[model samples]
Structure formats: C-alpha cells, structure tokens
Target: MYDSFRRDGVWPEFDRVDRQLLRAAKVDVAQVAAQIPPDLMATDGPRGVPPRGHDRMRLTVAGIACCEGGREDLDLFFHALRWMAQHEARHYPEPGKTSVKVTRAMLAKALRIPARDAVRLRRLSVLLRDERWGSVGSWRSTDDQDWSVNVGRDVRYFRRVRSTDDFIAATTAWLEPVTVATPAADLPGAASPQSPAEHGSYVDERVFDLVRQSDGARWDCTKLLALLRELDDNYRAGNAYAAHALLRAVMDHIPPLFGETTFAPVANNHPWGKTDGRYMKRLVHFRDQADDVMHRQISRTPCVLTMEDMPARAAVNRFLLGCVSKLA
Candidate 1:
C-alpha cells in the first residue's frame, strides 16, 4: 500500500520538525524511521535518521493509519488483505473467482501478524469465511497447512479503483465489521459488539473480573466464568447446539445471584426495561427451545435448533446486569 502511494508521489512522510515533535510525545522516532520491505530497513543506515534531503523524509500513510486506526492489528490486517486483492489476486472467467491463495507464512509477511498466533488466526479466519462478514465464498480449514480463501463477487469492485480516493472508497466497507440484521426485538442499541465473535459477547467483562476475584466472602463465580467462556467459544465456532446448552446453563447458574433457585422467577418478576421485558419473554421462549434441544428424541423428522433459536444478547445481558447490580 505504501509503495502504491510512493509511486503516485503521495507518500506521507515526516519532516525534521515532525520527527522532533513525535519524539517529544515519546513516540519511537527511530522505529518509525525504519522502512518496510524489511530488506530496506536492514541495509539502510542507522534507524531514525531522516535522509539528507527534506523531500526524501516523508512518513508513510500506512504508518499514520496504523497509529490512529483504533484497532491497529485489525486495521493493518485489512490493509494487507486489500493490498493482496488489488495487486496479487488471480482472476477467472466467473464471478467471485477473483481470489488469492495465502499461507500463514504469506499472511505473517504481509500483515506482520505472526504465523504462530493460532487463536488470532482462528478468530480472523472464521470472520473471513463467513458470507455475512468478509464475503468470502470458501476457504480451507484454519488447521489446513496452506489455508486460503476465495474472495466473493465483491472483490471485483474492491480491485477496480482508478485512484487513491477510489481505493479508499472501495475498501471503506470494511471500516466497521458487518453484522446480519436481527429482529427489531433485539433492540439495535443493546447488543452491538465490535469483535469477530458476534454472539455470547453479552456476558459482561465485569463478570470475568468477579470470577477472577472470587473468594469465600461472597460467591463462587468460577463455574459461571467457565460456562460464559464456553458460550462465547461455541458461538464463535458456530456450534449452535452447544452454545444453546451452555446459555441454558448460564441462565440456570445465575439465578442464585438474584436470591432465587431458578431463572423463571427472575424472568417473570424482575424489573427490566419495557422493551427489555418483551425480549426477556423471548428468552422464556428460548428456554422452551432449549428443552426441545435437550429432551426431544430424534424421530424420522428431528427438530434441529440453530443460533437463531438463541435469544438476543440484549435480553441475556439485561438479566445478567440485574444480578450483578444485586452484588453492589
């Protein structure tokens, strides 16, 4: 990406003053001075020295985006993916055939994300393979030795940019993670998670802290933490049945926090927002679905449940908050 801008005479560089200011702000001026294509950084003179001429010392736009894009790793990864599509993708006669074959080694080189980061790679690969998110048509399993994805039809436009502005416009679709619209009952503002694991994220961060700090003085939240962690993992892995079972476990486990033995009383009697109350009713419906999943035998026509059968994160989180507030 930087090379493209450099060739167009639009590479953003720092002047002597800019470097000085960055240094004053405790930025790693020396590190910033290093050039990419690794070979240049190694063969180039001492790190952090601007070239003799002022014209040759511009900061790359890639550097600016990395520092300011909020999610540095993801932003850099997105750029790498875009760069690969634009410059390296192979085109075929059919739609959605513009694709790039990538190995972990290739990704590590392009995005600076280490090939050994299996958890991160797994998370990212799940998103990339999802049609609703990355719009990928197919990919080898993350466990595959040479994992890669076939970019969907959208990549055709993703690579057709005539100028820098066009490139920006083309790739802006990735600026925010895409989510499939749920029913209006979910309350649009309630369950907005920015992470790739789109479901079971409503188990609050404070719950984790509470579990970590668990002692005899109050309650043991370790079981809750385990279930919540599994819930999140199953949801991200698209294991809908396990996720539903774990969610049911979560609802069963937390009732004690409300001084009740079961979730039914809390759902039926707890004070929550009017809309949240409506959603909680949906959660009650979900409990029946959970029963169907747990007790029903497979007949000639089995009743299979999916992620859609789970209640919205909003309802679950609201119920959780009610219990947590009791702790205060």
Candidate 2:
C-alpha cells in the first residue's frame, strides 16, 4: 500500500494491518471507505481513477475523521493535505522513512490554479494545525510557520509517501527570498558624488548588492545591468551608434528619482550642478545623437559616440543606482 501510493502502482490489499494503522492514527474507518471508492481500494478490481479531484468534493467521512477533533474548515484542511500529497508524488518519488514537511509558499506554488494569497495559505496552515492534521514549527514567534507530517505513520495512513528533508531542500530551491517594497518618496538624491568614476563604482556596488539580497528589486536592477554591460561592450567594440541607443533606453527605463521633473532641469539645476551637471550635459548630447541616428533624413551615420562618452555612461549609472536604492 505504501509503495502503491508512493509510485502510483497497483492498489494494495486493504488488509487488517492497514485498518489497524488507520485506527491508530485516529482516522475514521467508515469515513475512509466512503471517500475512497471501493473500486480504487480493491486489489482485484479494474483500475480506478486518481484522487486528483478530491479537492472539489465535499468533505468525506474519512476527511472529517482525519481532522483530529478540531473544528477546522473541512474544505481548506483537505485542500492543504491534497497539495502535500501531490507534491510528494511528483517531486520526491523514492519511498523513505522521513515524512514530508510543507510550507505556505510550497502550497502556493503547488496549487497555482488561481494562485492562493499569503492570508489564505496562513489560514490553511492554522486550520491544519488546529485539526491535528499536521504539526507546525518555527524558530521564533515572528518566523513563518513550517509544517511536516509522517504521512503514513503519524496522523494518517496513506498510499503515497516522501522524505521531509528532500521536500524542504526542493522547496527552498524553488522559492524566492522574500523582500519588503520601498516607496518612491524615500528615494535619495540621484547625483551624490564629485567624480563620475567614483560615483559610477558606488552605484554599481549598491545595485549589485540589492540584486543579490532582494527578489522584488531584481527585475529593474537586472535590466539596468544588462543594458549597461551591452553599452560598455558595444562601446569597446567600436559600435558607437548601438551603444548610444542602449544608453538612451537605459535612461528611459531607470525610474527617475525626481518624479515628473524633466531630465533637462535636473541636469542643469542646483544640487546636481557640481559634477553631475557636466555629465548630464554629455548625456543630453548623446540623447540628441540617438535622436539623430533614429530620425536622420539622409546620410545615416554609424559609430558616432566613442570612448570619449564614458563620462556620460558614468553619469547614467549613478542616476540609476540612486533610483534603485530607494527599493527596500
């Protein structure tokens, strides 16, 4: 029976031992018989359907019995358990002694039908714990709940099984690191250095660090990095026109720190006037070059911006880092 559930093989004999094990786990025998079809449980009968649609079905006698005496919502408790079973069947195929541990994030990933929210996942976990369906653990009060079960040994007997350790490792690999979002009002000054090179290096380090620590902040930082690298590569390869166009694209997308204020005033105005003003002027020049390259009526030129435009690139990098730093 264990092997059958773990591997989806033929049904096992529903013998006295199996019944005793279910009884020990506080599972209601009558409920199990009613929820699981007789054909599916029979060893000599024709092949029966899988338990995939059990989620849609109303709580069966077995399901209610499995809920250790707690008043947990039958629908959610069953749904969480079904998700755990499905994950075990698909990811951890080998039979093992250790039970499977499940987390809210794991449930969210598995049941992607409509995408469950954090609140729903939390509620489900609470219900499962209250019902004695599974045990919950956390290192600290503020930490997220972690759930584990001895599927066929602890709360209930099941045909399917998997290792708890393997499940944790797999889930950790799949889930993204959680991060807090930051608002635009918290953004710092876009230009903060005297030397363009120093400013560029500072921005690069901050943006890279943020990318490594945050999942939500990754997209924009990654895009900025890709464009910057391409711009640098094209400039070095003497594809000056391509580099100029990429720089413009980077500037357009790097979420401005100054809200709706135009880039022109920010470049020529105070606060940025010291060193950033000079670089901004160069960036404006490159923008014009990009415009000319895109809209020239005749004599379309190539490789207009050269290594001499490195300062403009530095300026843009600083601006991008300033914007990205606002992300928590």
Task: Give the number of the best model, judged by TM-score.
Answer: 1
Question: Which pairs clash in the backbone of model 1?
Answer: 12-59, 13-58, 13-59, 14-58, 14-59
lDDT of 1 by residue, 102-179 (tens): 555666566666766654554344334431223445567546345676454455344333433444566576555777
Q: Residue 54 CA error for candidate 2 (Å)? A: 68
Cα-lDDT of candidate 2: 0.46
Give the TM-score (vs. native) of candidate 1.
0.43
lDDT against the true structure, per candidate, is 0.56, 0.46
Q: What C-alpha lDDT, on a 0 to 100 scale, does residue 234 get in candidate 2? A: 65
Q: Which lDDT tens digits does candidate 2 get at residues 209-296? A: 4443443653435665677667655655655457567767766664354443455654555355456667677776766777765566
Residue 318's C-alpha lDDT in candidate 2? 59
Where model 1 places Cα greater than 4 Å from the true spot, the runs are 1-50, 53-217
Off by over 4 Å in 2: 1-222, 255-257, 265-270, 300-313
- State the number of backbone clashes in model 1: 5
